[model samples]
Target chain A: MAGQSQQINISDLDVPQLADVRKQLEEELTHLTNSFSQLKQAQAKFRSCIDSVKEVAPQNQGKTILVPLTNSLYVPGKLSDLENVIVDIGTGYYVKKTRAEAVKHYEGKIDYIRTNLETLQETIQKKQDNMSVVASILQSKLQAQASDKANKD
Target chain B: MSLEARLQAASSEYARLQAELSAAVESRQRLDAQLSENELVKKEFAVLTPNNTVYKLIGPVLVRQDPADARATVDKRLEFIRSEIKRVEAQLTDYDARTEKKKDEVCLFCFPPLSRRAHPPLHRQLVQIQAQIQAQGQHTAAATAATA
Candidate 1:
């Protein structure tokens, strides 16, 4: 793919043709960069979530807690065993885990997301570099075309 | 094919790929957010004892749930989310590969294949440029207002 695009001699194209190509590159690059930032934002939120869970887990241990009965009501309750926990994974599903084990699970998720973010960042950089090269070639061609028009006139 | 016709075809394909990529990314993020929420709940559940009264929200009411039952439910949910995340990630990977392929085939110049990155339709570029100009103008106006 790289070889095919590189083979195009920019000097062979006229001003309008070069401009058309440059415009397309700019739009595509804009889209790529936009998505990259969005992915970064999601990763940051996930990290903060992990930190919050880690901070709150220890304090709740062995405590007789007030369970919520409704949106605004609470019922007093005590745990039979502090060592056990039921985690709602999603879509009304539940799972059991120890507090320490749950924290480790979240930490592992954070690590996985971090790795994904890193890979995406690398790809964004490569796309940006490719866009810049295209821009440079387009600019030079446009400049040369202007000079040719001036000489002819 | 004429340059105009070829440009139209490539631009349309690029536009399609752009939309597909955005949708895939959005879905992936949503799934990740759901997973994070579940993990946080699991932490809370961990500190709870088996004999603790757990309230499960059934419809508008918080129905009493057996701690054992709650644990099993959450276990199932966690498993489902794990599988879902894998599925969504695979879909995202597939979309990313297709987008990359499309980009590679798109050569910016008059080449047969448009470079994977460049060559939007002229009208679309004009509209984008105009929008940017309008946004810049608004930014300056807001800055002046702040100064005033």
Candidate 2:
């Protein structure tokens, strides 16, 4: 009993213990929700990368554009290389890829993040179900105790 | 050592172990992120043609690199990160076991069973004595009524 794992019924727990479990579940849910939002933000970033790659088409070659030297600094420059763009692969490495290839790379990243979001959503749903179950059981226990006290009085 | 001192020591040890374990876990998470990033780069490298160029960013410039050499570098990094993760995992498990043992020691010191049995709580003893006196008074009242 001391070393082995055993499942205990939540209904058997007193009010304070049930409240503790609820609090823990609430914390986990919030953490998972934060991760979900972060993943969504990443997906948005990848989508924007795809759009930026598409914007640099061959038709736009030799066009004068305001290039960003800094966040608030833009320098007027002519677009020279429309066929190949330097893609920032992870770990501070960049690869020179054609326009189509850059789009594909960003698409792949978006797909990976989508899969992760799905799994995270499923986990959050399961935790929510557990939370509701614990909450209902706690409510019923409290009501029973209240009625018992009333009858004794 | 006194029980209080032992409990204090055990609790402090547990806290230290917890801090170290969290640090190890954080590093493991960082390594995992690095591993995944490298793997993504490796995948991109796989689909590259010989004409495609790879560059490593240094300070402020991109230096052209041989695709094969870049692949090798990424592979080596992945291997290193994998090894680091394994070592950290082992450390985490060891810390987990140590913390569990320390927690048990602290609990034993806090609620020593022998001391509890030898000297039950004062309120409980008082309650037992009061019940015994009430029972005796009731018995004496019944005896007087019988004599009358």
TM-score of each: 0.45, 0.84
- Model 1 per-residue lDDT tens digits across residues A24-125: 555555666676677677667756755655544545666667878899999888666456454444445444566565566556656766776787677668
- Tens digit of per-residue lDDT, candidate 2, span B1-148: 8544554566667667666766666777788888988998898899998768999999989999989999999999999999998998899789768867865765555443435456566335434543443343333323222221
**Which residue window of length 10 is worst by lDDT in model 1 chain A?**
A86-95
Q: What is the TM-score of chain A alone in each candidate?
A: 0.66, 0.92
Off by over 4 Å in 1: A1-11, A58-94, B1-148
**Candidate 2 falls in which docking quality class?**
acceptable
Clashing pairs in 2: none
i-RMS, each model, one decimal: 11.7, 23.0
DockQ of 1: 0.08
The CAPRI category of model 1 is incorrect
Shift of residue A71 alpha carbon in model 2, Å: 1.3
Q: Write the per-residue lDDT of candidate 2 for residues A1-153, one digit (tens) a residue.
A: 211257787788999767766776676677789989999999999999999999899788878899898999999998788888989988988999999988988998899999999988998998899899999999998999999999999
Model 2 spans > 4 angstroms off: A1-5, B114-148
